[model samples]
Target: MNELLSSAIKALGEKFGGQVSEFRDEVTLLIPPDKVTAAATVLRDEFTFDMLSAETAVDYCPQTNPRFHMVYIFYSTTLKVYLTFRAHVNGDDPKIATMETVYPSANWREREIWDLFGIRFEGHSDMRRLLMPPNWEGHPLRKDYPLGYEEVQYSFNFDEIDVRKPKGVR
Candidate 1:
């Protein structure tokens, strides 16, 4: 890590406890859910991570201890650097502090995460579905979410498919 980023990470670690990991030239900090807002502010003001490039989520199903991970990507235009912030949330009622206040662009990104991953952002002004319908029951992106796809019928199974086909179907 460069001197500036290292110093910033040190400051963040001092103020709020977090674990840092690096891979393929990407630095990711697994910070607490509650400290996200404050930490983002500090990074934006002091470290020059002015842009919230992207906000997304990852689901680790069947592991309730940390069922989901909210991935935050920050970009520093002047420094030409990218930093990642990750926060873990449990499967049951996963919720995290809203980044919308700090990064206005997070509005839709957070909504998309909520819609797909079912991870709610506390204090978000508008919490609603982004891509899915309002009445959608379960988050489709979840591993445990039911797959309702129908099996495709081939020429070999045409007889069987016709037997099950609707009476008035084309």
Candidate 2:
């Protein structure tokens, strides 16, 4: 890590009790769910991580201690660096305060997360499905989501396949 990024991570860790995990040239700070909003504000205003490049989530279902990990990627236009932030959201209440107040572009990104991952962003302006229909039953991208698929048949099984294939739908 460079001197500047090291210091910024140190500051965030000291201020928000964030934990750091690093890989190659990237660092991810895991903040408490309740402190995520305040920490994000500091990153934008104090550390100059001006752009919220990406906001997304990952679901680790069947292990509900932390059902989701909300990821926020920030880029510093002035310094030409990137910093990533993460927060652990409980399975029972998968929510963290919205980052739109600090980064306006989070508006749509958060919606996409909510739509696909089923993690809610508290205080979001338009908290609705971004890519899915409003009547969509559940977040389709979740690990526990039930997936339905049609089987493919080859020439060897054409007779068997034709027995069950519907005729009038097409």
Candidate 3:
């Protein structure tokens, strides 16, 4: 609702046909996956959203239309305003263009998303695991990723829990 944000939104809407959603005074521009880099470039170069504050993804599994939503947060020091961009990625093969070229700080954030969500970033300089081990089999953060849960033992259910728990070699 601020003057700068209003102008930015109008400029973006005119340049790129993206859907704008506002909640709690925060604006989110929903752009296509392929236009992420372009939109980010415009935001940084034209609107002065110079800093890429954070980049992350959310998994909405079972909703194949857009299984994941890639979220990017930007901040402008001069204007002291924040803007967010969200791009929906298909579930079949979740992938999107990298914004590293536009925002250098996005390099590691992209890598982290790749490592945790199995979402690939096309044109990434180094597309490798940022947090998980290189040998790690699957993305642990995915909604479909299997979790290893241990049975809880209590005074009354100790025997029942022990029967379900995995045994270790003595």
Top candidate, metric lDDT: 1
Give the runs in model 3 whose Cα sits over 4 Å from its true position.
167-170
Q: Distance from true position, residue 75, model 1, in Å?
A: 0.4
Q: What is the C-alpha local distance difference test score of each model? A: 0.90, 0.88, 0.89
- Model 3 pairs in collision: none
Question: TM-score of each candidate?
Answer: 0.91, 0.91, 0.91
**lDDT score, candidate 3, position 106:** 88
Rank all candidate structures by their TM-score, best first, as comma-separated numbers. Answer: 3, 1, 2
Q: Write the per-residue lDDT of candidate 2 for residues 1-170, one digit (tens) a residue.
A: 66777888999999999999989979999999889889989888888888988888988899898988889989999888889898888898788899999899999999998899888888899998999999998888889897755558899998898888767865
Pairs that collide, model 2: none
Report backbone clashes per prediction: 0, 0, 0
**Residue pairs in collision within model 1:** none
Model 3 Cα shift for residue 151 (angstroms): 1.6
Output the TM-score of candidate 3.
Answer: 0.91
lDDT of 1: 0.90
Candidate 2 structure lDDT? 0.88
